[model samples]
Target: MTVPGYRNVPAQEWDPAAPADPAEAEEFLRLCYTEVSRLGPVEPRLAVVRAQIAATGTYVHTTDELVWGARVAWRNASRCIGRLYWRSLTVLDRRRVHTADEIFRLLVRHLQVAGGGSAIRPVISIFAPARPGRPYARVWNEQLIRYAGYRTEEGVVGDPRYVPFTDAMRAMGWPGRGGPFDVLPIVVEVPGESPRLFELPEKAVVEVPIAHPELGWFERLGLRWHAVPAISNMRLRIGGVDYPLAPFNGWYMGTEIGARNLADPDRYNLLPVVAHGLGLDTSHEATLWRDRALVELNRAVLWSFHRAGMKISDHHTESERFLAHMRNEEKAGRPVPADWTWIVPPMSGGATPVFHRYYHEADQRPNFYLDSEAAALARGAGVRPALAAAPLAA
Candidate 1:
């Protein structure tokens, strides 16, 4: 008898009513016996597999009960995939191993006993190394050891392999492997309304201000204002899941030196911007940090597109505000600052806490805001245009 669910006839799809002819079943049984015969099976082990199944009752059913049964058929294949990756590692010791194909066969045997195929893809895609370290079984040994025992932060930062990094990297949906160590971007997406906090001391209402006239859409909704440190990175909650969306690296706006040197800062000034800064998966985080220091309200700067006045590519499909800035600047011909240098440190622990170490000030290339010089000159002095009245470009 063949082990139940381990091997089945290949069909376009599974059908419970399908009954294969007895002759075909007999031929399938002969095939299974012939397969086990090659593995050092002399006359004595002519058909070790079928006899083993006969004695073990492993072949009692034709189809599985629920999803697990439907999945058992693919278990052997899953382990092969796992071994395929494991054997590909160039860093592992190659002297002790057999052929890569044989190693895969043994690996498959060990994994197939459970819901093999169904479990492998998620594990591999989520955990398999984007880069292999070695070419031997040691790779599997290390992985199993760490997985069996949690040792990542125990000072055993483990082999900087692609699995762990990619796991964190997967959160950003940027599966892009090793192009360049570029700046990290974090994108948060909220639907209908901004995500909220679960427990506030005394359940106080939190108000996030809409500083830019361009973002009055936030106030038109129901967002409130709250004062926070300016040197911090963005830490927000979206879809009921708490997300720590900080700049992989942080910069400040002003410092003691000259107020434009790049200083590494921590996550600060955590607040959601208007609909503009939501739903991005890059490692970069953009927060709204008001620039003014007031008891109730103040001016803020969005650190991500801190170049709020500069012009991005006009060729982009989603490039609306960016292109508008360019168009307005070209009309003025003054050429806003094309460069930026974050300066100044965020004040620390006081009525206002900003870390001065990370302050930066970059030169502006072509600043174009209605509130900016162009905006001031276009509409006239101190006359703010209705930001809510403007529509995002088509």
Candidate 2:
């Protein structure tokens, strides 16, 4: 059965060996400059870019160009329902740093900066772009913060979705605490170096303990989740250049945790547990026990986050905001590229405003993409064999 938002749509393959296309650079620059009038005309900038691409294989993006390009990349993210605030993304330029230790340090800072206060700001830290025919540094973790999953004798402990990944980390000498919510170490790999594991300090990770507003026993379940959903492995492509290690984040919508992460059968699979706790009859589907449990679980997630003073949005409110974003984009005479499967909320599809409309589907450039190889690595494929020969680095 095809999952609602987790469709296996293939991303357009990127050839790392190929030089940056001057035409793509021109197209992006023209749009970028045209949108922001204060940046002035694109003619002079285009001339320099063309000349540089002719001489060298690629042209460097100026700070202004990089900033605008990152924001536009967020704007062009088709799967994201929160693109209404794309312009408000905090772009951290980390193009100069390359070492694993420094990169790890900055990543911790990125989380603190993003989730330190109650207001979780949307942030992206763009690392060095992949030069032509050159390997670039990247984080192996799909998201910067995820709990470790351990497969034991009886069944899987913690999140079953990450069991393979957790096993791979253990193979690489990460002594994972066999606990439900142990934060997995960040594996950073630079060119010509072994992937090193860096444990996230307690201060770097902001977590909200899950508890229903009224269910007193819900706290005993000991469920919690990280605040920031920073996707670390997706390649951030912008203006003909690809930043393989640009980790970006936005505050989570309640349903993402309640309906998908915690409730998915393959993940935490909390529906049955919650239903049992609620004393609902699960002997028949006609009882609608799962639906009742899902609603209550989602309510708990939203309530917990709100009580913690963390920024979170409900699926209903976010759907309305997405429609507002589409209207705003329409006024600008721009097409809003979106996937119908993703734009609609996974839990209540018929109830949301975005569910009723068809959207333009386009592979717009200056966007983020999950390369197949990166996805494989994130899921713990090719890890044991690749790192088996190399000694674990500090």
Candidate 3:
């Protein structure tokens, strides 16, 4: 969904059955108290949540806390380059939801709302949290919108990163049309059931077909990307509480699509293809073919999204905004934790402001995290095999 560091982090060994980390939970409550109290006394509500945490070893966030916590989580996401707009996140509280079907339905709405028309908005939908005895629901899509990867004799077709997950979906009985640009269906798994694949309604998805302003051949590559980058598989861990089904999105920074997704060898791997198309000298490492193609792909992504009237930002502008965000956080006496490798754009890193400075890498709480189990699930491993055949929800 989100790259681990992007939507992924190194897998931290954790027992799903273990109780909430008391110290972490307490710290989270303190944060909630401090933030919520700034609005009003709200001491009574805080007292109740505290008492519940004491009794049950867990507690529910009030509507205000959930909303604020989600926003704060974005602010605390170490790898996000778009933290400049953290406070603008729209939180949709669906913590009551536990079923695969309902989550699928809400995800459709999330896509429609976030990517509907050309109005790109940042939104997060928080679903049920993982507790001591209950298994949390999980979405298998690394992102809400992704192309299906089909394994062929010639090699993997489509996005290679998702080939395993795509196979897993097919094995689970999803009838996805195998094509290079086919939008993968959303697969949701509950603790006790088979993962269900829900097809995204076409109308809800807005895609930008890649085309270069000068290179006419670019459009013939048949490459297209979804306008919204809704990360669906990661957990939003706040105050020691784990919400495993919080799917959040922001508009893309052109480099993410152009440099990483489309150019990375493990992904669409289009650099060599584009370089060949451009008739570049690929004989030597110094030809800078990769660098040149990367720039063109990034250019095409920005142009395509712009032409389609979808929201997108160039790496240069995003990097500048991130610096402004850092200054603002400093003014507020908050240390912004950032991963320099991730904060800088994938292409032309040295040219961006973010690449010139060091950042605090200390992790902050109320941030999105990816666990080993969720990572495996995203790879298309069946839940029944992994969870000892937990009963499927009928």
lDDT per residue as tens, model 3, 1-394? 3323533455456566766666776677677777667656555665776777778877787787788889999999888899899989999999888888898889989988898778799999999888877777888778888888998889988999888887776666666687888887787878887666778888878888899999999989888898989998888888778888899999999989999999999999999999999999999979888888888888999999889999999989999999999999999899998888789888888999999988776668888887777778778774454433322222
Worst 10 residues of 2 by lDDT: 1-10
Worst 10 residues of 3 by lDDT: 385-394
Judging by TM-score, tell me the better candidate of 2 and 3.
2
The numbered model that scores best in lDDT is 2
Winner on TM-score (1 vs 3): 3
Candidate 2's error at 181, in angstroms?
Answer: 0.9
lDDT of 2 by residue, 1-394 (tens): 3322235656768899889999999999999899889999899999999999898889999998899999988888889999999999999999999999999999999999999899999999999999999998999899999988999997888999899999988888887889988888898999988888888899999999999999999989999999899999999988898899999999999999999999999999999999999999999999999999999999999999999999999999999999999999999999988888888998988999999988887778789988888989899985866675444444
Ranked candidates (lDDT, high to low): 2, 3, 1
Model 3 per-residue lDDT at 96: 85
Write the residue-wise lDDT of candidate 1 on 1-394 in tens digits.
Answer: 1222122312122121222223332433343335344434333332442453445422221111111211211121210111112112111111222333333332222223211321212211000111112211111111111101112443221122223322332332333323211111111111222111111121121112233344444334332222111111111111111111111111112221111111112111123222234332333433223221211111222311122331111111112332344345457462322211211122322222121122112222111111122122111131223311222110
Cα error, candidate 3, residue 290 (Å): 1.9
TM-scores, all candidates, are 0.15, 0.96, 0.92
Off by over 4 Å in 2: 1-7, 385-394
